[model samples]
Target chain A: MINNFHSLLTIMMTDPTNLLSLGWVDSFIIIVYFIFVLGIGYYLLRFTKTGEDFFMAGRKMTAWIAGLSFVAANLGSLELMGWAASAYQYGILATHWYWIGAIPAMLFLGIIMMPFYYISKTHSVPGYLKLRFGEGSSMLSAVSFGFMTVFMSGINMYSMAIVMKVVLGWDIHFSIWVSSITVMVYVVLGGLLSAIFNEVLQFMLIWLGALIIPIIGLIETGGWDGMVERISQNFPAGDYTHLWSTMGSFQDNPMGIHWTGIVFGLGLIISFAYWTTDFLVVQRVLSAKDLRSAKMAPIIGAGFKMMVPFIVILPGLLGLAVILPPLVGENQVSAMNPHSYNEVLPLMLARYAGPGLLGLGVTALIAGFMSGMAGNVSAFATVWTYDIYKPTHLKLSKKEESDAYYVKIGRWCTVLGVFVSIGTAYLVQQFASIMDYVQALFSFFVAPLFGTVILGMLWKRATAAGGFWGLFAGIGSSIGMWAWVKIYPGALKYIALSEHAKDMAENMYRALWSWLICVIVTVVVSYLTRPKADSELVGLVRGCTDIPSEGDLPLIKRPIFWASIVFAIFIVLNIIFW
Target chain B: MIENKGISIWFFIGSLLLIYGVAITIANVYEMISPSMEKQIVLRELNFGVWWGILLVIVGLIYFINFRPWKKGNNNKN
Candidate 1:
């Protein structure tokens, strides 16, 4: 065993840079965290007796727990590292992701979309399609979602392993195996219950552990103004500090996109598609105890999510202003230039945190990655069991399976999903470019799926044929656009409407076009095809469904009230940062 | 307080924070008492661990008390 471990370490230590040295105190904290999460899984195991319990946390999470989990599910290590890197590379413009790219979409999900999802009583987003459109669209979504989740989980795993290798000199294979096994054990044991509980915990850990970096950093840099001045001194050619002032043209900002792309592409299409349609996050809210909690979950999530930039972006800005040697981009990283933009967060942690605090910081990252893996695997298991396996096999077999049987399948599927993710991690390691493409593929379905789901919920005239064809067309066009750029690089100017447009701009515009195509196709096709009867659309469509009242609680107690307050803050934050 | 039966999630979060806080404070105190003759990180003299630990402990204690695992009924008021 010792010899094998040594060989594995030798083989997997690809990154020569080892930036962190954890003391015994730090190791203890990490060990304690691992043990505590596993304990929570075991403690919740008894409660996860039925399929509902396993898949939906017995539908009993409060708004606070579910809300935090909703945000935490998306707050993976990759997001933190990537956004911080973006901050270093693109300046305060990167904050657009957390603020404009996320807040409005999250509020929309809470105020507009939650009622449809909660009232429909669907197990998954694809399940909602099964109700609204038919089996064809549902199966397409389920199969695509299954592939996306597993691949995305693998990408998260690979990213975590790389971070560990770079920062702590841990073996990639060892990190992969240990994290996969831990996530598998907990999720298989307790399913979504374990995932949600751990997500909330991860959320707290991320805040506490990472909040120190910006705190110490701001103090060292003499506050926001000092940091901005230092950044300007370091690089005066670019407008990295201001948000909107530099967004008039693609050349004005480092991100190489106009305000229209930021507002329409990212803000409207990608954000709404993700926040409203992604089952990984929606599952958390679906587990809420009631409709009010369901609505409030995303509202509360938006409130906290708006604050994430402080820990993520501020640290990168601090690193740029205060660190002696500027960090290089990923392409520029080499033996001579050892520091990459992605290393900013870990580097900040190493610089600012003492031994014990360092351990906590590392734990926070581990928790983030693990929660992300759990979120993906659990969602995959749900879709696979409910939308894929049951529909394709069980219904055909005509077997009356027990709820416990389905729960057992969910457990086994979670294991299978983790194993598949491990395989994908190895696959990603072999071809680095596949990781980028796989991540892009995850988004290819989002905008189109959002179009179909939103249309099905709001428009009773949308036919089943229109829904499936529209989704198919949108997904096809998105992939076609991506291929157009890849095959003909010059086409990007046409697609993004500027020669200065970059990959980020390409993504936003792609989502926008795909969503528009989906809507147009659905509208055109619905006019040609036979529409579903209004009677048939009873509980699913807006005009036919009688929306449930969330109670005449005092004005302050309503979700819309809180949502309004959060939206006001969102607007205020944009202006302040602008 | 998922399902209002198991331990409150707040209590669980608080307990973890309190333990980490206490451990960090102890380590901070130990390091301060016997300064190591090595290069230190930024703001080591500021005793960030001590103060951050204390803050975490105080907040953790508040959550722990309000939604104590020992008191089942005082949870999930939302």
Candidate 2:
């Protein structure tokens, strides 16, 4: 057993440099994957004839397709690389973002929010906001979302380029251009359907590509207990293994976030904003054929989401346990720099996967990057065409244009969006860490958007003026807090309760404060402003809307039944990990 | 037209194998081309990509032939 373990360790610790080089088979596999993606887009182009087809997949998607796309769209290189890096840096505590931060919000979206969104038959989140709170709130959200989507697309582009350059010595510009052009082609041709199809395909690839590393590592370590023991031996950070143990206070955790900050700031504010309101994710559910499928989509996504941390996070722990120590030992820490912890996933892929598998793994990373970019650009195209162009450009014309005309505009927006994303990718070069920058962006836009959305949906009294100002207040507060943290540098420690928690606290606490400010401002302004009549708000607000009755399905087939089972499993996992 | 009953199970299975095959081929080829002292011990032991790729291709082809959507029927919507 001892001899076998040592041999396994020796095999796992093969020189990292050799792992970076790709062979012919790997290149062929990658080429094939790209061809498959492009082919699917071309094939789907015939189906996307009208603007509705372009933006919403003709509202014909089933529960599984929409559900897979919903989860896959979010499971980009950003999530994989960013969370893996976070897992390396913050340990199992990073799992909070996946479980508490995502699952609950996703479940809430399916159960509580899908009814309003589906019943309204709006084209986008901004369109729904327009129906609920009028043009003022809608325009604010549409413009903000437009910019956010393009920026996020660029981040994915930049991340993909960096991985390609680091792993295969590919030029960063070459990588970015190849991916951008490929994503632009399919998205422009087939629109949201193409993106959704590719997202589903990429979802499968990501799982298959990523599954091997953890399986190999666990076998070597003997299992979960063995991995925990080996990790402790190598790193001696007991807190890293336990999820909730280190989360007692800001000072106690490697993440430097207290339970209050984790539970409220991220779990409540950031997660809810991203899961329930983000157009990129919500648009998938909105594409479902019926209300039941729309609601079931997110419930299915939540179940899949619960299993994701094991795939993305475990590799980071494996890197910390097996890969980093040898590099650190050799005084070659520069090779595996702690600051560029995002390299952890790529590094593990190189070490574990041989040629053919290696190609698939790399293709998986590329697919993730493309799927993320495609999702963002498609969502951007929908908002830009419907909200921005239709209102500003089409409104000026005396005659109403055909659906084909709008489809043309959507295609143009896809082209424009991709170019803008390429430009934004260059901007991402300035950021030290992709995840931190992404989280900060989310706090700035999503947190505030959530504030208005929540108020508009739940409180019929939320006037257009109140929704607009509340959203504005939330965004302003988030930016102000970000700037304050930058200038003072020491302020986060004071606000967050521990000196160690300062960096992460800046984002979490900013989200919390921004949400508070938005809610407060909205409530105050709502009272001052005259709200729309109940007639105008029919089917828009919770009280005014009729709940779609669930047909008498069997317990096993019911969404609520599956959601409860997921929640129970989530509780058990947390307790065990705690 | 493909029914909204979701993607066929056989098609999904075929795709998964093809992906696995391609991935394995890439790994094996990389090992063969980039031979080193450390790699020789591991790479020489496992040259599974080509055979695996061939096997997966055959299985995938069989599935595709049996479950091709075009053969089932077509819808005028396209």
Candidate 3:
């Protein structure tokens, strides 16, 4: 019976094509992580009695907790693996995603935008839209956000399974079922509180597990200077080590992007859009205990976000420098050189980590994926319950539901959302390219929504008609541009405005165009329509709102002070790398 | 974070790290003693498992003691 059980367990868990196998020590650590997260959810269940507690964590998180959770929610395995792969493919140009592409926008959200969001007491980003714009704009935002969140969640699920299959030889079905069920249980039981707690845990686990890669790699390659020398020696055709020196011309860099595209398109539009408007990340800040904590959270997040490249990008650089036989792209992968660029982080992990550390690394990846899915599902539940279901239900029935009733709906939505995501995951598994389109679909909404939200907050003269039409026009134009490129292969030069621009450059330029169209349409429409009264716009718009001072204790205590420090560091890092 | 009144997150992290650290350390030491059972890993000569495990144990102990539930008035609820 014991031998039969052992064989059954092995058959259920392991895949035949796996490149690495975990020892018992590694397996034990993974088991502990699952139990730890589930235990947190189960333990927190009693505290999650009300809708606010379930959906917003009762707004009692400190800056550190909320900050770490905010960063961790975006620090998914997909983000890690994908960016690491990009580092190997495009070199240190990929660091722009973490640095210029992220830090400035994150600081902007904390210092400039958090006041509007916090003072408004909105539950989600669309909730803010309803107050500033109207029901129509809010509904549009909520529906698109809801749909995209679940779709992305499913993609994360599918990606996790694939990673597990490739790295650990786990069966895809087993990986999917186990991880999905685990996420569903915790999320349903405790909701956002559960998600936030797990996110914080995931953040720590990620650092502990993955930080070793860069440390070991640096030791192996002599150090940063040594790694740079080795990488430069290997790829002398293009400057791969310098961040900004080669960005003057598209042909000088591996990414085929101009500095303007990096600065204006990504650094300005895309980064601000995703960081400020996306409810998935903003919801973490909204869980802060007070206005000050809310204001401080993203700044703290920005500081840590700067350091992530060491673990993520450095390993990829090390791979380019030292890994033998070379990692190839998916199309070029074969039985002999089976690893693809997507497998860079895992390949590095397999190279350095032994039994005990191997478990930690795998656990970190699992934690990252599960937390990412949880973030998506929890955001979906909030939007569905608060934005879509509640408003629609009340408008039709003309009755206000109790908070408990909505909390119950939120719980049910969590379950339903998980099931939908699982179904979507299976669907994506059948047609892998669906994942790319799903990610593109996310970009379509975010850039446009940023225009709507920023205009709504900064310009009091912006009317409801303007907000709605601007969002509609922005999304429509983004989709149109995407389809244009799809239909006409030559349209890329027209859209990105340079023949040298690659797919990544095209995405940035497209976001910039969609945002401009949104702003222009909004400006024209707002001038044509009557505006909201200043009294009505008090907490929603910048000029009309009375901003509260966070109170001066010391320069060191202020969010702005830390933000300035982070900004200074940002500029210095850019200059040093330049 | 208020829900953490039952148990602090730090304490939980500490407990898990301590457990893992000790396990890894013991596993590494046993392999060192028995030489034949050790798996070939990169930088194995560095004895990373021993030192890293010890570091984890020390950090974990600090967190575990500081936030342990049984300690007097140890609830670090935000």
Model number with the top DockQ: 1
Candidate 2 lDDT over A293-381, as tens digits, reads 89899999988999998789998888777764432221335644532566787777766666566766777788788888888999999
Candidate 1 lDDT tens digits, A406-486: 998999999999999999999999999999999889879999999999999989899999999999999999999999999
Against the unseen true structure, what C-alpha lDDT does each candidate score? Answer: 0.88, 0.78, 0.88
Instruction: Give the candidate order by descending TM-score.
Output: 3, 1, 2
Task: Provide per-model DockQ scores.
Answer: 0.68, 0.28, 0.59
Error of 2 at A525 (Å): 1.6
Q: Candidate 1's residue-wise lDDT over B1-78, tens digit each?
A: 566566777788889888888988888888888866663889888989889888889988888898886675764442
TM-score (C-alpha) between model 3 and the true structure: 0.97
CAPRI quality of model 3: medium
**Candidate 3 lDDT, B1-78, residue by residue in tens:** 474476777788888889888877877776667654444767877777677778778988998898888887777554
Candidate 1, residue A173: Cα displacement in angstroms equals 1.2
Decreasing DockQ order of the candidates: 1, 3, 2
Q: Give me the displacement of residue A226 in model 3, in angstroms.
A: 1.6
Worst-scoring 10-residue span by lDDT in model 2 chain B: B38-47
Candidate 1 vs candidate 3: which has greater DockQ? 1
- List the pairs of residues colliding in candidate 1: none
